[model samples]
Target: MDVTPVMSSASTPATGTTGSLAAMAQQAWGALSYAARTVGVPAGVRGLAVEVAYTAVHLSVYPWGLLDEALRPGGVHAHHRTDSLPPYERSRLVSDLDGSSTPVLLVHGIVDNRSIFHYLARTLRRRGHGTVQAVNYSPLTAFTGDIRTAARDLGDHVERLCAVSGVDRVHIVGHSLGGLISRYYVQRLGGDARVDTLVTLGTPHRGSAIAHLLPPTLVPRQLQPGSDLLRELEEPAPDCRTRFLAVWSRMDQLIIPQRNARLEHPDLDVENVRLEHVGHMAMTIDPEVVHLVACRLGRTRSPRDRIAPVAAAG
Candidate 1:
């Protein structure tokens, strides 16, 4: 009976097993914490928090101004709340030009109406960048219809704006998908003849990975990396006369790997402006962005000035 020392395998832990289990437990806790901080919170609750913060700031800083802007006739709210207005009326609202001046067309991103340009338009107007207008297109249309169709529509608006403003060329500013539409019009649709300078904010020129997160609809598909539409857009535009200024933020939540917002065409005149800690939506409201846009609009520089493409600024 030599049963002196019998050690069970289950009783003795293997070498590094304790460390591995501890590491796994730590990883699990970290994942749980991250989920709690992000997806665990109700979307409505987050929205409400943002609204509450905005309301508080509005009331505390400029209560009367906010009320007037909201309630007054032909005010921000009245003008932006154009859902009931006819298509012609909306277009007219955008194309209203008082005198002969360099027209600035504002194009908003996907799923957004022209109302998003309210603050930016006002800022441009105040900065004396006369005749600022915004164009609205359907997000569903972008999904169902080809992007070229949207470009054609934008071209039509540009032509109308130029005709009304008595200007042969207009400066275009677009955000997100609007920027893509503008570029298509300028490069592929021979819109460079009509557009002098093209400014884009938070645009995805190289396509965006975030598009994959969206439904596999037409627009999203077109916006994904290496899409046919994007490939066509990336083609050389040697004769394009438009000067491009691409403005992007480092912390843009929508444009995945934010550098996608930059324009990298070799044959075209493209400049990149980097913004710090600015969100995609805030790009339209930020004073610095407004000032940059105003300065670019204020002066009429020759296209040759942009011959050295790929200029960068902070």
Candidate 2:
């Protein structure tokens, strides 16, 4: 399949900042009050039930934390002990290259494991960007802690993989909460040194409506709006060495108010692109998202090359 990498226009107009704080605060308060009022009344019982059921099935079948010590492109589900899949080794773009192909690290969001990017990994590998790695985490833990720990683990995994592959640094692509984690790694944990590029798909950088809707006890208070993590991302930081591409979907059902899905930063190099049809989950499976990732991986063959999703249609 032919792939043309999509690049947002260079003219990245500054997103409006007027009343953003008040609006966000209002949303946060409303969500908090709603959760408070409906503490045990089953706030969105259907969504909660579906979320619980999906996780139960995944944990029962694919528990990987017990056996796997490393993360790879097509590694077994972190929840279930299984074999790690090799890096995507058949990129149409890098098939002819020697031993310097750039690696891509894939991470999933809350309540999810590495399987989220299975389709994307397979497609990118077929296109010749075979050095893909996926990170898995336990969903029951606090989301903030999970992101911090995952980044540290992922950095180590990248270093070890690079030693074996002879590639210095790799690209990072995160979905939903994963994206926020990647940002934390870069902003606070100094992950920019190890990553060449960062691509975030449907990440709720500013916080989410669903999080707001969840009862306070079920959701960690630290991850809520105005939390320490979001505060860090809000502050201006030096331009990271890693190029960033943020892909968002207008139809996101989980990220309430959808617009909060995109991160607005003043001192950063980024491309904010919006995809209309895909929802939060569809980002991992959609072909358009796959193609975009392939193009990024192909162009970023070496650490020197820097470059950087979608709706839910399953």
Tens digits of per-residue lDDT, candidate 1, 231-314, equal 998788876768899999765667876788989988887889997656677677667888898777666555444333323321
Q: Which candidate's lDDT is highest?
A: 1
Model 2 lDDT at residue 112? 71
Worst 10 residues of 1 by lDDT: 305-314
Model 1 / residue 116 / CA error / Å? 0.9
Tell me the alpha-carbon RMSD of every candidate.
12.1, 15.2
TM values, all candidates: 0.67, 0.66
For model 2, what is the error of residue 91's alpha carbon versus the real structure, in angstroms, after optimal superposition? 7.4
TM-score for model 1?
Answer: 0.67
Best by TM-score: 1
Q: Per-residue CA lDDT of candidate 2, range 1-314, in tens?
A: 54333344444323334467668999899867654443334534433454456446546645553234344333522212112333443334345463225677787887777766766876765565546667776666443355567667767776776776676677889988878778778777777776777889998877775676554643354356666668867886764666678888765667766677777887676878786656567677667777886676555534334322001211
As a whole number from 0 to 100, the lDDT of residue 151 in candidate 1 is 96
Stretches of candidate 2 off by over 4 Å are 1-100, 143-146, 215-219, 301-314
Stretches of candidate 1 above 4 Å error?
1-100, 302-314
